[model samples]
Target: MSIEKIVDQALQDGYLTPSMEAEVGRICNTASELSIEEYMALDRLMGALLTGEVVVLPRKQFINVMEELVLSEAISQAVEIDKDGDQSLDVGDIAAYALNRLPPLYATTEEGAQYQRSRAKEELQSLIASQVKEAIARNLDRAAQNQTVLGQISDTPLLEQMNILLKAYAADYEPDDESEPSTPN
Candidate 1:
């Protein structure tokens, strides 16, 4: 099945959350075929789904931060307006002043949506690149741990032991610096 179909199915089955579905869509829409980074991103995303390791930010905290920023801007603008003269605004005057300075709140235009999708895809790829590095590091750590345990079990040459330990993760291993950055294709 296509990635979009898979994501939709996962979402409907409660295996993936809406935010994750959005990220998957971002990945799929950015390219006709997955790049190495995209593949790793999808891998991490699915792993999160299967392992229930999804990290969701609290909605209330996001709302509070947004509200704080908006209010701060409004107050700043109100102060500027009041400073024009030695005038003190009553509650209603301040409210009206703040409201007038606020930008229109409405649905995004198609151009805006396109820009947002592009930005999201870039951010997702960047996040996935870091995740891939971390995954590689973890695998290396596990391999080292296994090597230490197995070394105590036998007198295997260290080179042979290291080879065996790393073989699992070496098949597709490429240093991040050696790979081209993921771009839409």
Candidate 2:
């Protein structure tokens, strides 16, 4: 059976929910067609998943991927003419290096492909930022609820209380701070 079908069957049998199966399939497909770098990323992702650390999932993988990308680029840049007078590191060779280095089964649309070609890392960064933001929002909501019930803080003070909690969160964690910087120095 196709991998998609396998996932579908898992859902019908109550082994996996629709969302769980989708996440599994998405990661599986990406890992399956991966390049050397992408393979490393996916493995790191799996390690995080196995440990119940969703925040660290793609992040660990990204660190590996970025390292590989830098190392490979450096190696390619260092290539020079050999004794036989042949220039090293041709485009076809680099293309092959890249072909095996990205996740498999990326969604396709002319626009999406163009976006991928133009700013691939941008998309990944956006996804990571979105997830981080979602987690923060969820935690903030939960904290607000708890503070209201336990501390007897008024609902009118929710915004202020959330900010205080968020400040504490920022102190403890390196939040995904991708927001635009201030204009003044």
Model 1 misplaced stretches (Cα beyond 4 Å): 1-24, 58-98, 101-185
Local accuracy of candidate 1 as per-residue lDDT tens digits, 21-129: 6666776887678867657656765776667665433332111222233344445544664677553434334333333443323224556545544554455434333
lDDT per residue for candidate 2 within 54-82, as digits (tens), equals: 33212111123432333344344434223
Residue 41 local lDDT, model 2 = 49
TM per model? 0.21, 0.20
Provide the lowest-lDDT 10-residue window in model 2.
55-64
Q: Against the true structure, whose TM-score is highest?
A: 1
TM-score for candidate 1: 0.21
- Rate residue 72 of model 2 by lDDT: 46
Please give the lDDT score for candidate 2: 0.46
**TM-score result, candidate 2:** 0.20
lDDT for residue 81 in candidate 1, whole number 0-100: 48
What pairs collide in candidate 2? 35-100, 35-101
Clashes of each: 0, 2
Q: What is the C-alpha local distance difference test score of each model? A: 0.50, 0.46
